[model samples]
Target: MQENKTSFSQRLTLLKQKEVKQTLVGILHGVERESLRINPDGGLAQTPHQAALGSALTHDFITTDFSESLLEFITPPEVSIDKTIGQLTDVHKFVLENIGEERLWSMSMPCFIESDDNIPIANYGSSNVGRMKSLYRVGLKNRYGSMMQAISGVHFNFSLPEAFWQEWLAKLGQEANKDTISAAYFALIRNYRRYCWIIPYLYGASPALCGSFIKGKLTSFEFSKIGKGTYYLPYATSLRMSDLGYTNSAQSGLNICYNQVDTYIDSLRKAISQPSVDYQRFNGKKDGQYQQLNGNVLQIENELYSPIRPKQPTRSLEKPTDALDDRGVNYIEVRALDVNPFSQIGIEANQFYFLDVFLLYCVTKPSEFFDSHLYQETETNLSEVVNRGREPNLHLTHKGESISLVDWALSLFSDLAEVAAELDEANNTNQYSAAVEVEKQKVLDPSLTPSARILKILLENNEDNGSFGLNLADTYKKQLLATDYQFMTADDLTAHAGRSVQKQLLVEQQDMQTFDEFLRSYFESSTELEQV
Candidate 1:
């Protein structure tokens, strides 16, 4: 740990000398929250995408995640954290105005789901691409169950300025190219695996869940009874990130290498191409209706669920890997964050700043080559934190050795303090440092963590998962409706929605192939990753 401290300190000193503080970091933030409408009897809302939010297929900022009820709000990359948050808040405001009696679920986990058929799959318009999108989700529902598809979280898309990387490359005497930049980002991912468990330990809010979620699934742990049909681990942080969450047992054995782009792509390619005996039963159609996209382990690359991923925006009909192969990683998406139930918006600005620092720490710190054993170790540590993170003197593995969670978190924060200072110096604000201090307090006092706080509230209220989340949902809905849009005007938002609807109409009209032909071409097509 001392060696880790010294190495980061030296790197920070060099970074300061390069005077890269003014480099503007861009954030492409998006929040995906699944909610149920407040009907006479509380149940999952069976509603279509609201007309006010625009077409789910063509909207840039508003779309459905998996279910029609699951609203995902996206914000374009913005340097100003305030504007970024403001935009997201406005999206929520717009949505609330139109949802009528509906309320967004404050937590990451879903409410009391009756059955898989109760949840409606998201419907895109009548286009080949749109049909493909819906078919892929049908595949997900067939393979994993609709209940797991209802699980939602916020994705933090982060990218540093190219100038910052160019300066670092020059300082390190390395060539500046897509391959070099990508290698550096991969190194960052390696380090992220080493310490990202701290994220759920601090921000994980889904410690409990509705019993219906686990009704048909495996149940081996002891759970304290809340209200009717609700159970939670006494010290659990995020049951949503646990094995019971979005995990697929088939993909668990995949030892994907993140040390380079090619290795990562190769592993994903093989998984999607390889056939799985478990999924083969669902490969054929039922009554001449396609049950799934194909018999492969993964319907597509996007089916591969991970805590983090290297991302590049795809072109029309282009695959995720196609975009990545065409250009190196444009940004890294941090998918571990559970939507903060406390805030009206899914995330706070300070939370964004904290993540920015943490990601920067991952890239700047020295990273060793990661392997299968270490990757599984990362999963083990994360499971421990998610299931029993608040347990006194909890232990986690670091580089194959046991260390107290608090000790490791504190040591990591020490390095982050320096990072915050440097970023503040560059940005001419103390917000980054202030955010670091706030997170530091979470590590120092476990009670201050969001997971702990949520558990405490539940215990005090004697409320179950459904009742507690419903209460928060009502509160947030009222708050959002009361507030006006801060970033964009109401008319501007409506105009964007209208235009997106028009765009979807145009795409439907321009379709050249049948859904069947399009699906076949997509699978049989030989798409190659662009080499540098």
Candidate 2:
């Protein structure tokens, strides 16, 4: 047997390495312990509902406030069916214009977050799924473009610059001042800077919009009561792709990410054009990635300047994952796909294989800045997935040329299957490949998408007229209520929360807790680095 004698730090570093390819896609919920309600006064109301937890850092029960009633209200009507590219672009514009664009983004990523309220839930990102499905009813099937604007959720890799934060804290004086809402203002600003501004009520209900904090004069309270780092925001990315069927599970999200997220980031970079940090400020890109309008040059502040902060990137090729944050590196975000209610979690063995392979593809493929033209095309894929997926023959732009959706999906699925098989063989886990084949068959078969079934039931909802979201919201609440509340012991928390869920949760939970508090004694209750 191999000698298990690695030192603690070495083991931690190794664990972090194992998590590199995983990307956090927060499994999101609209309502938590306290579900938010939109008061007629344009304020947010946090109902008594709250997500229960034994500690701030771990979760034994996964709960959400998103109600089925809400899901129905958000589902788009089954109209405006456009099938071609030109027609699709028009539909995309229609959705974006109506959606009132302005959203969040990640660094160097070209996606957007359109301003909308209440979208569908449940296996949302699979196969062009979600409340936005009705665009086809109007002959405006600009597939991906429309889906892009109808985003639902977000995931991120949080990087807190402790020293920069300290400087900011000093500037704010850690207390409410005559300037009014200075700390809160800056907190929101920080949230914006880190792409953490997925405001809870941005779509409709917002606690901050109506909470006592809005009325108070900023007493001795810390900003973390709202959340720790970043909160996963709803109405930002969840689009049920499964309903469109035929293996297009990521359409809804891919649309939102590439369309809304990408454009919004570009807009933001333009909005905050002043020099906050040059390219160098972003670490390994330490050389400062831009030139000032006045033609001045820049570079990152020396890493020694903020030893408490994550170490600055050492090489040009360094990734954000190399450094530590409240959460670790890019963690696995299993998109709730191939909604197998039989599994309760909606993911199946084959789906897991596909995920592993798909992740490997994302990592191995050239993710280098894809050109701007590709963004819209990516969005269109969602619509194609939603409306045309099951048709056996579909079209998509591949490497600058249009190709069949069936062909593309099949190819993509096959590649993923291969990767899963390789992973199994390498890990001595053939079961992984078996799972891939199982899911591959399911994808080939036309089945009910989670949203489809939910919407079918949603039509029966009495609250809203035609919204399919109520079902999902109810499901979320039900899941939360059903979650095992027996607080896991410390050991159990360690077992479940090593890196994956933390990455998933952190993407939505950044800027939730302040760095000072995040690094404080309260968080100490979680565990030492070794335990995670």
Candidate 3:
């Protein structure tokens, strides 16, 4: 590890000599924000997606995640992080104006959903693609239950510009090709796995939940009872990332490798194509409705849930893996960020800059192949942090040795400081190092962390996740509604909404194949492979 760190330093010095620091690395950023719509009474909003928000099926920036009540707003990739944030803010303002007495839930956990049946699955129109999207959600609900589907968070999409990659390859005297680029990304993913446990420790905001959420199942852990039904682990960080969040017994056994793009894709491809006997019970349709697409372990590539994923934007009607096979990774999605209840935009500028630094550190440092043993270690480390990150002098295993979590995190911050400084120099701004400094404080003082702050607020309010989150939601709602929409004009957004609706209609009108035939063709075409 010491040698690896030195190697990174040497690479930095070489790049510095080449004046790579002067190049403005295009740090493209976008955000996917998922929030459940809650009624004025703090219960799940039973209404359909508001028409004013545009057609969920065709809108580029706005869509539904798993359920109709869960609104997901996306922003276009922007060189400026503030521009991306501003776009998200504008989308939220637009939705709030049209939602009418409903508020977006501010936290990752759902707000007072009474029953699974009460949760509304997102509806798409008559087109086969739209229908497929809806049916995919149905499969998810049948597998994971509606309660889990209602949980929401923010996903950060990030990528480095082509020029930056080209410059790095030149510095290394390596050819710029898809294979080499993909290998570099896989290296980043490997390092990300090793250090990803730090993410939940810093940004985790879901430390507690309403009593209604758990419903008295799995009462093994000590939980603080604040209200009649609120339950929380005192030292917890992100319960959202814990086993209680997303789990599948069958999928757990699939130890997919991240050592190379081919290995990763082949593993996922097998899972999606392979049928699982566990899901067979729910495979057949009853009463003119399909229970699920098939008894496969995963019906599609999107079903594989991970904290981080290498991604390439797919062409129309293209499978995710197919896109990766054809083109190298376009960006990586950071999916573990809990919606910060304290902020109106769900994430802060400092958090974005810190993520940039963290990701850069991951890519620059040496990475080892991720095997089954390392996979379990990463999983265990994340679980430990999510449950008891704030415990005094907490320890976690690294390279088969136990070490203090705080000590390890502080050490990593030292490396991150260098990366931040270089990034700051390239951008000619102090923002990067300022962001690192803020996160460093969180490592030194856990109470300043989002999870700790959430617990503190809950303790003050009698341990009520629902009421506390709802109040914050309402406050943010007012604040966002009052703010000016700077990135886009109201007319421009409305026109975009109208255009999306027209596009959905066009899709519906142009469909020539039956739903079953369309499904068959899609699966058959996507599963076809070129001879190696």
Which candidate has the highest TM-score of all? 3
lDDT of 2 at 519: 31
Q: Which ten residues in a row have the lowest lDDT in candidate 2?
A: 298-307
Please give the distance, in angstroms, between residue 28's alpha carbon in candidate 2 and its true position after superposition.
Answer: 19
Off by over 4 Å in 1: 1-6, 24-42, 526-532
Which 10-residue span in candidate 3 carries the lowest summed lDDT? Answer: 523-532
Each candidate structure's TM-score, on Cα atoms with residue i matched to residue i, is 0.95, 0.36, 0.96
> What lDDT would candidate 2 get against the real structure?
0.27
In candidate 1, position 181 carries an lDDT of 79
Q: What is the lDDT of candidate 3?
A: 0.83
lDDT of 2 by residue, 417-524 (tens): 655654554445576577656545544643333323322332343222111222333343344334442323334434433443454354344445543343343224
lDDT digits (tens) for residues 456-486 of candidate 3: 8878867588888888889999999999998
Clashing pairs in 3: none
Using lDDT, give the best candidate's number: 3
By lDDT, highest first, what's the ranking? 3, 1, 2
